[model samples]
Each structure stands twice: as C-alpha cells, then as structure tokens.
Target: MVYIAEENRYSDMPYRRCGNSGLKLPAISLGLWQNFGANKPLQDSRDMLLRAFDLGITHFDLANNYGPPAGSAEETFGSVYRSDLSPYRDELLISTKAGYYMFPGPYGEWGSRKYLLSSLDRSLNRMGLDYVDIFYHHRPDPDTPLEETMGALDQAVRSGKALYAGLSNYGPEDTLRAYDILKSLGTPMVIHQPSYSMINRWIENGLHDVLREQGVGSIAFCPLGRGQLTGKYIDKIEAESKSGNSSMKPEAIEPARIAAFRKLEDIAKRRGQSLAQLALAWTLREGGVTSALIGASRVSQIEENVKCLEQGPLSEEELREIDSVSAVIKDIPW
Candidate 1:
C-alpha cells in the first residue's frame, strides 16, 4: 500500500529555530530508538512514521546502535523510506549518530575519525540516503582527541555528506571545547541531544545556560522519565506494561518516587495537563530547547503526546512545586 502524507501537515504543529542555524525542527520530533528496532513489527513502525509525518513531525532521529541488534532500526527505516517517505525527502530532517558500540572490533565504536566517518557511510547505505541533514558524534570520547573527532565532523560537512554537525550526551565543559574546535573549522555545532525530563534535570545544572548563550539548540529525549511522569505506574504497572524491558523497571519505581509522582500528578491536574503532557511542556519551556524528542511504539501515544503543544511553559508556582519533587526522582536505575 502507498502512504501519502497529509498536505496540511505543516499546519498541524509548530517549528522552532535550531540554535542560530537556518534549520528549524518540529516542536516534537520522533526518535527511532526502542520501538522501531527489528524486534518489533515493521508495519507498526511504518504506521508510526506515517502518522508522525501527518502530524508535522519533520525530524526523525537515529543512532547507529539503536536496535537490539545494532543498525536494524536504520534498516527498518530504510525499508519504509523507500516505500513511502522518499517523495517527501526534501521536507525531512534526518539525523544519525556514531560513537557507541555499533559493531565488533576496536574500530567498531568510538570518536576516532576512522570510526565516525565509516559508521556514517554505513549509516547512509543502510538508510539509502545521499546525505543526512545533521551528523553527530554521539558522545564524548575520553581517549580520542576532541580535534580529531571535530575534524571528522568538519570533513563530513566539507565532503557534503552532512549539512550540519552536532553532539549528543556531552557535558557543558566538553560542549564548550568542541564548539570552539568546530567553529575554528568553520562548521559550527548546531544542536545537542540530551537526556532530560521532569525527574531527570541534569541539563539545568549548567548545559541549558551554555546552549542558550552559545546559540546551540537542544533536543531533550526521555521527557517522561521513562513512564514515571506518564501516570502509567502511578497506581500499578499494567499487565501489558513495557516495564520489563524499560529503562525504568518496576523495582526502580520505589515508594519515594511514587510519592513525588503523585504530587506532580496533582500539580498537572491543576495546570489542566496530564502528567505526561506536563513533562513534555516543561522541557520545551526553556528557550534553549529546540524540540522534545519522543519515542512511541503505538500511534495513540503519539496522538496523546502531541497535545503537549496545547499545554504550557508551566507557571512559576507550578515550576516551584515540580522542583520539590525533583530530588526523589533522580538517579533512576538503568
């Protein structure tokens, strides 16, 4: 069956500028991490992509090690792209990253120029892409020289393999250093992907201020605290709950965490937003954040989360209340 995107999709959502760059991403982008892996049904993944595009999600994020078996998510995305999204290629913002355990051997992972470029080439092949909109050095490498990694990013842009370069999961000090190197190379780092949510707020420590001042945009992933803020486990984990394989397992949701969650739920109700919606809205409140990178296995989850657009930059009172719950929710077990 042929999939046709909605012509009015552009009006379904809003776009915000990514840093000072010319690129603008949807307020909520889709991430191909867990549910899009080979372990899941291809048709379900395809349907999610189509519905996301129809709802104006222009950016789709991927990483080389996203699947149970690394690289399978990209392979799945490639299959769907060839069958459906190829026609709307010009309207999409596709990004893929390296610097994680992608394959075997020493060269399989890390920030070395050899690994980053080769991994990107393989990524392009897997996705059948001429070039990704932005290519990223997925994380900071302690052993690899920052210059070598940044140079590979610059080389990628100079070679026309990627339009812009980015960094993910990097801390404030490292981001500053990398930005200086990339700027000197004349290929500025435009964005950062960070783990952020109501419960997990490390970016608030300093990264948010740095990104805002440096004109680098941030896309926050896992804004729901892996279902803690979703009201899913507020009462009890459901029979069909994904808690078994979830990063936030049942045992990790201790009584202390639930007490804090209950408070947040009450606050969200007063704000006229669900716990999940409030979590998403809170991440977007900061001017430095470009988008909320959300993952969903089903279409209904996407539909429900998109309503975050209708929510808010929570009030000062609500914000204070949320801060009170922060301590109880941090350092969740992996």
Candidate 2:
C-alpha cells in the first residue's frame, strides 16, 4: 500500500531548540520502548510509525534491548523503514543505543570499545542504514572507564556510523564527566535521555543545571511515569487493563502511588483535561526539555497525547499548585 504524509503535519507541533544545538526537535517524540516489538502485529506497528510521521514526529528513538526478545524492535523498525519510510529518510532523525545486554559473555554489553563498535555495526545492519542520526549509551557502566566509553562514542561519529552522540540514565556528576571527555575529543555530547515526570523529580536534584551549563539537550523518557501519572488507575487496576499485567509488575502499583494518582486526577478535572494530558503538559512546563519521549500501546493513546501540545504551557499558579501536591506525596515507585 502507498502512503502519503499530511502536508500540514509540521504546523501541528511546536519545535523546541535542543540547548545550543542547530537542531529543533518536536515537543513530543515517539519512542519504541514498548509495543513496537515482534510480539505485536506488524501492520499495527507500521501504522503507528506512519501516523507519527504524519503528525510531524520526525524523531524515533529505539534501543537494542527494547524488544521482548532483544533486538526485535529494531528489526521491526527496519522492516517499516525499508517498506515505507525509506523514501523519506532525509526527513527523519533516527536514533538507537547500545550498552545493555544483547549477547552472552563479556563482549555482549557495556562500554568497552569493542562492544560499542560491534553493537553499532549490528544495529546499522539491522536497520539497513549506513549511519544513524544519533547513537547513545543505553545506561552507565561503572565497571568501564568513562574515557573508554566516550572514546567509543567519539569513534562512532568519526567512523560515520552515527552523526551525533548521547548518554542516557547518567546522573549529573557522570554527565559532567562525559561532557568533558566528549569535549576534549571534539565531539560534544548533544543529548541526554533520562527518566523524568511530574512524579519523578530526580533530574531536578541537579541534572538540569548541569545540562544547561554544558549546552546538552535533554529528552525525558517515561514522562507520564509509566502510565501512573496518567490517572488511568484512579479507581482500581481493571482486570483487563494493560497495567494489570505482569509486564507492569504488581509492586509498581503500591497504595501510595494510587493515592497520588487520585490527587493528580483531581487536578486534571479542575484543568478540564484528562489526567494523561495533564501529566504530559506538566513535563513540558519546564522550558529546557527538548522533547518528551513517549511509548504508546494503542493509537488512541498517541492521539490523546498529541492534544497536549495544543494546550500550550502551564501557568505559574498551576505549576505552584502542582508543586504543592507533589510535595505532599513525591516518592511513587517510578
């Protein structure tokens, strides 16, 4: 089947400057962290990718360990890339990461120069791309020297395997170290992917200041707090609800979390928007966030999230009220 993109798609989203970089990214970017794996139907995944493109989401984030059977998500994305999005390659900003378990033994994961370089080659081969727009370390490896990790990232860009380098799940101190190493290597880090939300305030502890100082952009993953901040579980976890499954882990649905979700739901009611919309808008309240990396299990969820950008930024009073409520119940097993 032939697919044509919407002409006015770009007008729907407001792009934010990525720190001091020359690039502008959509306020909300789609991530294949969940539901885009081989476990799901191929057509459904393809439709989601095409629909996101039509809505002006040009950046798609993936990782080697995203799928249920590791690497399946990239393979699925590769299929769609070749069959549908290949013609629009220049218009997309594709990114993938390594530094997680994929194969067995020492060479399978982490920040070793051999592992990173080999993983990039495997990722590129799977995606059928000569080079990705951005490559990232999935997470920090305390066992590996920071210099060695940064060196591999530097080489990835130098060898033309990736255009830009980024770090994910690294704290402020580690991020600063990475920035300095990448700077000395003459390939300054461009982006940092971290878990942030109305409930998850770890970044606020210090990471934001460091990123701002270093001019490194940030894209927050799980901005909705893994569907908790969405207020979907206000009453109870429905038997058929996706959140009830083992994949979500029952421990994540603690009593404290439920109470906090209910309070957020009340705020959403006052704002005249769904709890999910409120949660997404809250993430964009802080200006430095270049994008909210979201995962959706259904097309309806994506459609709901897209409406958030239309509501614009939150008011100061609204933010204050949110802060007040957050202070009362901040720690929610995110």
Candidate 3:
C-alpha cells in the first residue's frame, strides 16, 4: 500500500517551541532509543514511524549508540525515511547525539571534538541525512574541556551539518556553562534532553529553573519510568529480560512501588485515561518539559500515548495527588 499520510495529521497535536529558537516540535515526539534496532523487524519500525507521523509526531529523536549493536537504530530509521518519509523532510525535526561509548579505543566516545564531530558524521551517514535539525552532546565529558566539546557542537551548526545545538544528561551547572559557550560562539543552544517522570523528580531540584532562565527548551525521556509507570506492573511484576542493557531491573519493581502504581492507575481511571496517558500528561504539565519523548513497541502503543494530549493537562489537585502517590517512590540505582 502507498504511504500517504493522513491529511488531518496536524489538526490535533500541539507544537511547542524549542527554547527561544524558531523551531517548534510536536508536544509528543517519538524516540528511537529502543525497539528500532536491527534486532526488531524493520516493518515494525516502519509501521511505528509512519503511524507516529500520522498522529502529528514530527520530531524523532535518536543517538549514535541507540541500537543494541550500536548504530542500527539509525540504519532502521534511514531505511524507513527513504521508503516513506522522504517527501516530508522539510516538515520533520530529526535530532541525534554523541557522548556515550560507541566504538572501541580512545576516540570512540566522550565529548572530545574528534569524537563528537566524527560521531555526528556517522550518525548522519546512518540516518542518510545531510544534516540533523538538532545535534546534541549526549553527555558532559568529565575530562574534555567544556570549550572543546561545545566548540564541536557550534561547528556542527556552522558547517550546516546541524541546524541547532543541544545538550543531554548535563547537570544544571554544566548546562549553564555550555549555554554560555554556545552563545559566545554565535550559535544559540536550543534544547536539553533530560530524564524526568512523576517517579523521578531530580530535574525539579534545579534543571527546570536553569532552563527557564537560559531560555533553553527541554524534552524529557523516560517519562514513563522505563515502563514501570505504564500500569501493566500493577497486576503482576515481570522481570526485565534486558536487565542493565535496556529495560529497568526487576528489583525496581518493589511491592510498595507496585502498590503506589496501583494508586496512580486509580487516578488515571478517574481522569478517563490509561495509566500511560496519565504518566505522559503529568510529564507535560505546566512548568514541565517542552515535549515528552516516548518509545513504542507497537503502533497501538503510539496511538494510546498520543491520546495523552486529548485529555488535557493535569489539574492542580490531580498534580498534588500524583505527587503524593509518587513521592515515596525512589529512583532505581542504575
């Protein structure tokens, strides 16, 4: 069948500006961090990508080391893009990052200029893109001078290999420093990707305030807490087969946390939403990230998650109740 997108795909989903930049990403973006690798069927990856676009998810986030084999997710996305999304290139906001362990040896990872630029080239090559919309330093390199790393990102935008610069997994202090460096280099830092969810509120401590002050937009990953907040664990706790490599560990699913998840599920029911939807809605509430990045194993999961926007933002009372329930839940020591 031909893959013509739905005409009304842009009708319902809202697009939020990325920091103070001219770019605006769909409030709900799809992430290729998992399930889009060579290990998964290419057809499944294609289906989810097309369906997410059909639902107005214009932004697809990726990284150089996303796949199990490393670089396979970008290949999968490249295949799908060439086959179905080629014509809509101008309408998409594709972003990829570096800074994690990718290949072996000295230049394989970290925020060094050599690794960052080289990794960006590989990412662009794997995705079959001439340039990415946003290029991010996946994490702060403790050894690499901040100037050298930020310089590479600035150079990426200057050379037309990336339209904007971004940072991920950087703490509040480092983010401010990176922002200053990018700004001085004449390229405005646009967005920051951080891990945030109802269960993990680390960003609330200071990251949000820094982002607001610096005018950088934020997109939160793991807003579902690695699927723990999906409510499926309420009835039964299954061990995460992937363990450290991928999914959350079974130990994180303690009995008390499951009970708390049940309380959240009850709240979701009262709000006329599924647990996943409630988690996403809460992640995107006022003063939250600019977009909530979601991963989907099935097309139906994407559909269900996108509907999180339809029920609207969580109310003050709902927020309080959610906070109370999740307050006791601690972040897994990964």
Candidate with the greatest TM-score versus the true structure: 3
RMSD of each: 3.3, 3.2, 3.5
Question: What are the per-residue Cα lDDT tens digits for candidate 2 across 237-323?
Answer: 433234545343464455555555677788777877888888888888776378998898877788888888777578888788887
What is the C-alpha lDDT profile of model 3 across 196-289, one tens digit per residue? 9988888988889999998999999999988778766554453443233435566566667667778899999998999999999998888889
lDDT of 2 at 204: 86
**Which digits, one per residue and each the tens of the lDDT, describe model 1 over residues 7-70?**
8999869899998999999999999999998999999999999999999999999998887578
User: Scored by CA lDDT, what does every candidate get?
Assistant: 0.87, 0.85, 0.90
276 Cα displacement, candidate 2 (Å): 1.2
The residue pairs in collision within model 3 are 19-217
Q: Give the worst 10-residue stretch by lDDT in candidate 1.
A: 237-246
All candidates' TM-scores? 0.93, 0.92, 0.94
Sort by lDDT, best first: what order?
Answer: 3, 1, 2
Clash pairs, candidate 2, are none
> What TM-score number comes out for model 1?
0.93
Query: Per-residue error at 279 for model 1, in Å?
Result: 0.3
